[model samples]
Every structure is written in structure tokens, then in C-alpha cells.
Target: MNIASDIKPDRRERALAALAEKPDGVVEAIAGKAEVTPAEILEILPQGAAVIAGKDRFIDIWSEMTAWGTVLFIVHTDDIVLEAEGSLPAGSEGHGWFNIHGDSPIGGHIRKDNCASVTFVDRAFHGRRSCSVWFMNDKGSAMFKVFVRRDENRELIGDQLQKFEALRDRYAAS
Candidate 1:
């Protein structure tokens, strides 16, 4: 989210700063299954999900003090991982394909070829710590990583790994 103004600050940025003042802008999350609007989600979302899910950025020490605004920070990552929301593999709709062809240098197909597991990975959950989710494509060559906490990201990485293996049972392989 872009809160930076060439000359001065923006309105949304000012509002976000005020929102973050106490207890980290308390009460900004939901449980069970629910749909949310993009506007309010900006405040409640955890940092990692915000960034990875393309939310605002807080990249500096005096970041919030000065800029203190949050709209959406545009980041240039080496590679962008697109989510396959509510879809299955091979059977999915558009895009989300890996470069697994013969001429492609990024060889090694995504394994586990279980369509059911693929769908589950795309689904987010109310992880104890946070919404922990790891998604490996059908071929399993590479995987996408996400966690609620940066330090703990590695901690539950194993759990998610195991969950990946176990999720095959949760859904019938498509």
C-alpha cells in the first residue's frame, strides 16, 4: 500500500496511524469462516500476510513514527507467488502453472499430484499461532511458505510440512 506522498501525507495514511496507536489497533481479526472488506482488513491483518498477500509495508525503524501511514506498500520481490484460491490442480481454472515443460530450466515437477491436497493448501485456517499455510504444487518440486510470525515461521514450518503430507486424507484426491 502506498502511503507516501510527494509533498505531504495522505488521508488514509493518517487514519491508519491513529488506528495503530494503542494495543496495536486492537480487535482486527476474525474467526470461524467469514468474508471481509478490503478497507478494514488493512488494519487487522498480521504483518506477514499483509506483505505476502500484498498489503502495506513497515520496513524501517522510524517507519511508523514518520510515515505512520498504511494504505498499501508496493514491493518488488524477486518472484511473485500467486495463490490458487478455492481451486484444484490440473483441474484449476486460469494461471498458477509451474514451468515444468521440457525446455524449461526450472525443472522438477511438483509432486504429491493429489488434487485434494492442493485444494486444502489453498484454504486458510485458524492456526493456533496464526494462519499458518504452506503450499506445494501438485508436482512438489518447490513450495510457497507463509507464517504469522517471522521468527516462528521456521518453528511451525515442520508442522505445516507434516500437515501437507496429512492433508491428503482431509479431502478426496480430485
Candidate 2:
């Protein structure tokens, strides 16, 4: 059985209702309140709000983001949220890991094999339009999130937004 499909109708309704009522609410907070994983939340989000692709697209997605200029790379846990602001470094696969090496502030090894899904999320965050790509593990937890950077006026960077939308469309179509 598909675990995501096992979520009760009421739970799905509640999640959707929460999004509708508080469009700017943080998804992680909503997931916590609704007792669902963030991945499950994304799955139930309204069409156009999210598009999920397979882990096999990991390298392709990351490669595309490398040219998006400065963006926010976030790793959130119960205790802390780590934010790194920089362009995604191009990565190479070797020795069971995807290693990122560059002059950027973010550089590390990612076990891409453990990634189950890559979700492109376009939602309102803190009352601002936000776009992010979430890399999620098999357990439905986000491994990391890369957000499109905003300008001084707090608007989504135009070119990056276009690129993000294009990527979402390309993957969502296939």
C-alpha cells in the first residue's frame, strides 16, 4: 500500500483547509500541527502549489540551481534551522556520495541515493511569495530546501523565478 494514500480523508481536508485559511503559514508548522510529514503535506497541496519529481532528477535539479545566483539553502530540524546563502555549487558523484566543492558557503556531501522525492513548492511564506525545491528522504523528511532569492523589495528575483517555473513545468510534465 502507498503510505501517502493511507492518509485519511479528514486529515487531507484539514491540511487543505489550513492552507486555505492561512496561506502564509509555514508548511512545516502546518505539518506538525496536522501530524503529517511535510512530504505528505506537499502531496496534499492544491495543484500548482507543488510538483513532485523522483530522486533520479536530483543531479539535474541541483545543476540547474547552480546558475540561479545567490539563494537560501536551508536545513531545518527540531532544535535549529541552518541557513546558508550562496549559489548551489555544481556537484559530482563518487564513492557513494554527491560531493559539492566550490567557493560558495555551502559545500558538503549528499547521499542522493537516499532521496525519495524532489518537490518544487510555490507557496506564500510569511506573507511573501516563496519558491523552493525540497529534497526529501524516504522517511518523508526534507533533507534540505533551496529557495529562490528575493530582492531588496522582498520580491522573488525575476529571472530566477522564471527558471524555477520552467524547471517545475519541465519535470511536472514528465
Candidate 3:
């Protein structure tokens, strides 16, 4: 059964229509205007656009991401979006938090226990192809997102893209 089937049909149709009209729009925003959750929107995305993996794989996935080179890490709330461009630092679990501390500018303590799933999204954003790894909480909200960075010509960095695709494929199968 479709995970979002419980939503009213009219509302689901409206959300689908909106997504079709604006495929690159921020999903959270689209879901908000349509009175749906971001995870629900993701569930209905065009085939091949999104793949989900259980949070049990978070550590392995995060470990691989540390080698992805410079990328964009985004943390957002209802009012603001904060972005950091750097290599993801290696992290370790201690005292109920995942401590991320290394030479990179990205450092913090993440509540890894709260992460419910990891979703790999390959889609367009602002008219350009983009790829991101979304860490989602149980409430259907994104805890944060790690986006593959674009180069000077506004193209996804090839190495990172390969790594991202490989990682997605590796996890999507299991």
C-alpha cells in the first residue's frame, strides 16, 4: 500500500499537481502549502527520484559521506536555512550523541538516535540537477541534508556524484 494513501484524495491530488508544476521547488515548502508532510511528498515523487534506507545504516552511510570531498550541508528550520560548504568530518557516537569534530568547518553533536531514515534524492533544484542525502526524523521532518556540490560551470562534481550514486545503489538494495 502507498504510505500516503491515508491522506485525503483531493489533497494528495493537489499536492501531486503542485509538484508536477514545480518539480524543483523546496519539498518542505510544497508539503506545507499542501498540508502534507515532506516524507509524504517524497513518497509520491517521480520514480527513481528518491530512495529510502533505514536509520540503522546511518553510521555506515555517514562514514562513506566523509570521503565525498567538499559538499553542502544544510540545516533549516521554519524561519531560516543554514548552509555550510566543506568536507563532512568523521563522526563517532558517545554519550547519546554523534559527535562530529574534525579539521572541517562542520562540527556538531547530532542526536543520531532521533534519525528515522536516510533518503537519497536525485532531482532538480532551481533549474539545475541536484542530489542530496536527507536525514529525516520520525516526525517526517528532515533533520538536515547533505547536498553534492556544483562546480564553477554549475555542474555536479563528478567524483561526488559517482560516490553518491554508488552509495545510494548499495543501500537501496538492502
Candidate 4:
């Protein structure tokens, strides 16, 4: 299910629509059921539910996200889903690779060549309005996702939400 090759376009769209209706729908689960990648699900999201930003513009978006304070960085595999909650470190780029390291445990050598696109998904999860920034690989599978984290009371962080919306609006408008 890493690729949507086996799924019909209409069936993929229907899966996305069904996922949208669930408050705590799991994108990976939906993608699995639809025989598609989570990134593919994001790609087919209805208008206003998501925004696409080309990989060429990712540097600018990455810069903005690095300053977004603490967030939830997720990296998943079939067996495990690792989540680190902290701020995105200031990354250094050299030799076509971006290296990130800081107080957060989400440091890695990001191969820019594998980045295919970026998607901003403004959707509800766990009964709350949430947003995720997904980095897709060349195969259109998500390499990782950076999501807005909530406060101690389990409430959404207004400032972060605003920033997410601003980023979405700014990029979508351009």
C-alpha cells in the first residue's frame, strides 16, 4: 500500500471522504484499506482540506517550521510509530543534504533528493481541529509528519494553530 497503483481513483477519493468524516481516523489505516500511501490520501484531499507546496519551495516552509516552537514530529514504519515532542532544530544544509540537531531528538540527515512534495493537511483528529505538515518521498509515501501539539490541558495551542493556518494560507495563495 505504499503506492496507490492498485486502487481506482474513485475508490481512493471515496476513502478520503470517509476518513474525513471520522473524528479520530487514522490516515495510515485508511491508506492501508484503500491500498494507498498516506501521502496519496493527502494528495486527494478535497479542496480547502489540504494544500500542496512543491518541493522546490520546501526550504522556505522548513525555515518557517523550524521557528514554530515545540511540535510533534512523527516517523512511522509498519511495526512502530515514533513520536518526538519538541521544537524543530535549526538545520544546516551542505552537500545537498540537510542535517538537523538540537534539544529535540528528531535529528537526522535529510536527503533532499528523496523529497517529492509537501502537503499541509488541515483536518480533525481526536475530535479536535489539527494540522500536519507531511514530507513525501519520491514514491509519494510520507517520510515523516510534523504536527501541531496540544497544551497540558489537552487543548490545541492557539498560537501554533494560527501559525499553521497562516502557513497554509500564505503558501496556498502563492
Candidate 5:
């Protein structure tokens, strides 16, 4: 009963590909006990966030037994970005960037409630910021993630973000 076989690809790859279809997105995956049903997983959202959800199986990269399961979701990345502390980045009129939001292992936790680092190309092309949002630990390495991206079309960008935010207010689970 291996559903992963029917997909004919790895779940992480499959999940990433799903997010790729949307220009700006927030992809997510969670790995816990196998007996945990999908319904239970969906119940963990904040009391008000419309999280467009999905299901795909992931091999436990760390487990000795390959029998455990994982769940994935891809929300519009901007919803989380709007939670940023500073002004919304005016993405290059027609460019994109990885806006990372999470706690950095350093004193980042104490400095900001939501520590965000935007990846903007600086004077030097090599000096670029890495964008990511991962579920990590005390030492700060990701165990899981909420994939994020942003687009600069202002109109379309605002629409997509509003759509996601509206969904959150309507169907946010916790």
C-alpha cells in the first residue's frame, strides 16, 4: 500500500513541484508519528489562517524504519511576509525574492518576535541573502519548513496575499 510509488517520485520533490506551479508560495511539510491522521494535522493551524492544504507522503529521512508518514501544505508566501516587522519590500517592479521569517539560532529570538531576512541582490552580485522558513530547534537546523516566496507585480501580488489572508480569517484552524 505504498502511495508514494503511485506518484513515481519522492514526496519532497513532489511537494516542491506543486509549489512551483504557483508564482509566489509558502510550502510546508510535517513529520511526526505515523498514527497521526491527516485531520489531526490540519487542526494545528492558528485560529485564523486559511491554509490551502494537501497530502503527500515523505520518507522519514532520520528514522531507521521507513514506515512513518508526513504531511505537506503550500500557502501563498506573502501572507506570512505581511507579518514582517518592517515595511513590505517593494520587490523590484518585476522581480522576486526569498523573504525568510523565523527565529535565527542567534539572539534573533530576543531582538524580534518574527525575525525576517530578505534576500536582495546588493552592489555585489555575490552578496545575496538566502531566503527560507524552516521548523528548527535550539541549535537551529530545520526539521520541517514553511516554504516562502514573493513576487513584485504589486497588483497581482496584493491580490494573492489578500486571497490567502481572507482564507486564513475564514478557515484558520488551531
Candidate 6:
């Protein structure tokens, strides 16, 4: 069965229209209305955003993220959103998982099997065009988010934005 049909057309249209009116509120709100996850909404984001199937390229993406100088690494659960700011730790695969170990605060053995996709989210935050790499799980839940840090004027760091654009351009699967 096409389960998506469970949501009526009018409801979906209203949700999408609401999203167009306020992109920032779209994911969670629409997902709730549609009975889907935020990651599901992320996949159908407008043209400017890129959703990349990243299971095969997890390591490559991880490696690139490590070089971003400093970034905000975030994880969340039902209760709280935990954030760590620093370079991503160098990681290696062992025992069927990606082992992250370094002085960096963002260190843990990421379960390789849980990673399902990555999304390059484009939006504005704090008056600056926000850019982030979101790693998601099999159920389309956000596993973590890595954000490009901004400068004193709340502007995206030039080199980091360049790298982010390059990575998204090079890896976004058609």
C-alpha cells in the first residue's frame, strides 16, 4: 500500500503551504501533521537544499567534517539537546563501528549501521544563511547535526562555507 496516501491531500497541501510560509517551522510541524519524521520532510525540501544518500559515503563525510576547524556537534533525545563545540575527532572503524577518539569533545563510537542519509540544510538563522550537515538514522530521526560556525557578525565563516558548498556539490547524488 502507498502509506503516504493515509494523509489527505488537503492536509498535505496545507502543511506544505505552511512550510513555504515559514521554513524554519516546517520540519517538526509538518512532520507532526503528516505523521512522518523530520528527516522525511527534509528529503522533500525546496530546490536549494540537498539530500544525499550517504551510507556508502559516511566515512568520507566524517573525514571531511573533521577538517572543518571547529563546529557544533549536536545530539538530542526526548529531554535535551546536547552540543559540543570543537573539531570532530579522528575516527576509525573497529568492532563493526566507527570509533572516534581524540582530545576533541565530540568523541564516541558511532554505530555505522544506524546512519541512513545526510542532508545539507539551507536556511537562515540569526540573520545569516544557515548551513548544516545533518546525519540521520534509519527511522529518519536526526542522529546528530554539524553546523558551520559563524563569525563575529553572525556571518558564515568563508572557508567553511566554501568547503560545505564544495562537499555538497561534489557528493549530492542526482
How many backbone clashes does every candidate have?
Answer: 8, 0, 0, 0, 4, 0
Report clash pairs, candidate 2: none
- For this target, which candidate reaches the highest TM-score against the unseen true structure? 3
Better of 3 and 6 by TM-score: 3
lDDT for model 1, please: 0.27
| Tens-digit lDDT string for candidate 5 (67-118) | 1111121222323422222212111111232232323221111122122211
Misplaced by over 4 Å in model 1 are 1-9, 23-49, 52-129, 132-158, 161-174
Q: TM-score for every candidate vs. truth?
A: 0.21, 0.91, 0.93, 0.86, 0.22, 0.84
Write candidate 4's Cα lDDT for 1-174 as tens digits: 123455677877767665666626777877777666677676555576668788886678888998889999998778889999889888888888988888887788888768888888888676777788988887767788899888888877889988999998987887
True-vs-predicted CA distance for residue 80, candidate 6, Å? 1.1
TM-score of 4: 0.86
**How should the candidates be ordered by TM-score, best one leading?**
3, 2, 4, 6, 5, 1
Candidate 3, residue 142: lDDT: 92
Candidate 1 lDDT over 1-174, as tens digits, reads 221222123433443444444322211222101222222323234433322211111111112112212111111123553432111112111243322333222233333222111112222233333332233233321244332221334333444334433433333221
lDDT (tens digit, per residue) of candidate 6 on 1-174:
012344457655665665566666635556676666666566556666745656778888889888899998878655778888899987899998899989888888888879887778877643457888888887867788898888988788989999898888776645
What's the TM for model 6?
0.84
Could you tell me the lDDT of residue 170 within candidate 4?
85
- Candidate 3 CA-lDDT value: 0.89
Cα lDDT listed for each candidate: 0.27, 0.86, 0.89, 0.78, 0.24, 0.75
RMSD of each: 17.6, 2.2, 1.7, 3.6, 19.0, 3.5
